[model samples]
Target: MTITTREDEERLRLLESVILNTTDGVLIAENDHNQDSKIVFVNEAFIKMSGYNKEEIIGLSPIGFFAPDASSDELAKLKDAIDKCEPCNIVVKTSKKNGTKYWVNVSVAPVSDGSGGFKHWVYIQRDVNNRRRHLQALEEQNKKLKEIAWIQSHVVRAPLARIMGLVDLLSEHHDSEELSNNQIIEAIASSANELDNIIRKIVQNTENVQNQSSL
Candidate 1:
């Protein structure tokens, strides 16, 4: 029995240490109006991320870290979700103690005691600024590609079709023209040659674009 008790104590200590030292920010808050939703627990990672020591924040409202001009409606919605014991995820701009604002992906879930009473609220926060910037860049590139595809399909193709149709018309009336109309025939032949050159250039340009896209 003595050995068993010692082992159990060791296990609990290890679990607490792991939670406190984890790299991801973790916080626990109570849902009471008098407490002003004060933080009940915060891991070391949360301290580092928020630039707040445990002593400074343990009994203070976490919402104070949010920007002063932040939307109250959004805060109300978050509070309502917590009140209903529902889990929710939201992107919020939070300010550090130094007043620098940054975007965070925050997930909140209710913690309940085994007896069905509300215990605390758990929050997980991750910085998402880099991920958001990367997604924005990808959206811009996709928009440009769509524009290029439209130009190729409609703008470039229309003129090429007209040139090809003129060549076909010349071929069909080849026998009806007089041999003495050499100059007119030469002009028609030169126009056809120019059209062929333009089509080749368009094809090369399209190929270059496709290769760049593949890269």
Candidate 2:
């Protein structure tokens, strides 16, 4: 039999409360040969995050358990880490109980059994869907900016230069051996139209960068 003081009980309650209420999902998995890294314990936050009950979560393999949509390469990498008994941090798309998918960052570390042997793996899962969306938005914006730059530097330059040269030629001579007056004006109009189209494309791309990030 064991004895516990009032202070010990209070401390235990505090620990349990903190673990249950924390926003980050926390779970413990069995690490022995018999268990094959199946989950043994999960906190309330994990249950809420996974959209599954505590009973359903327990006894399930932590790897690919919540993230069925996770790629094989990601699962293999995590399996390799588990095989080596090393800590691993991976981000993958996971499905909730409702079948909707979200991004999560799962970090797992080996927990010692106090006998100099590995006993369990403690996983800390953080929902990172917002972060992933923000990153993708930033990437989209960067791509648009690069395209705009290219249009300004290369595509826009050609038409503007053509327009400027045509105007200069019109100013110098209404009719020339190289071209007629109407031909020069037609060339100028064509260059202007091309420049207008390029500008519209750049504007469309910029608008896309702004609108597509709503996802």
The Cα local distance difference test for each model comes to 0.72, 0.86
Q: In candidate 2, list every pair of residues with a backbone clash.
A: none
The best candidate by lDDT is 2
Q: In model 1, which runs have C-alpha deviations exceeding 4 angstroms?
A: 1-5, 33-35, 52-56, 64-77, 97-100, 174-215
Which segments of candidate 2 are over 4 A away from where they belong? 1-6, 64-67, 168-175, 193-201, 204-208, 211-215
Q: Model 2, residue 36: what's the lDDT? A: 69
* TM match of model 1 to true structure: 0.69
154-202 per-residue lDDT for model 1 (tens digits): 7666656665655665667644454334544565576667656666766
Tell me the deviation in Å of residue 203 in model 2: 3.9
lDDT, residue 166, candidate 2: 90
Tens digits of per-residue lDDT, candidate 2, 103-177, equal 999888988789987878989999999999889889877887897898799998999999999999889876867
TM-score of 2: 0.81
Q: Each model's TM-score, in the order given? A: 0.69, 0.81
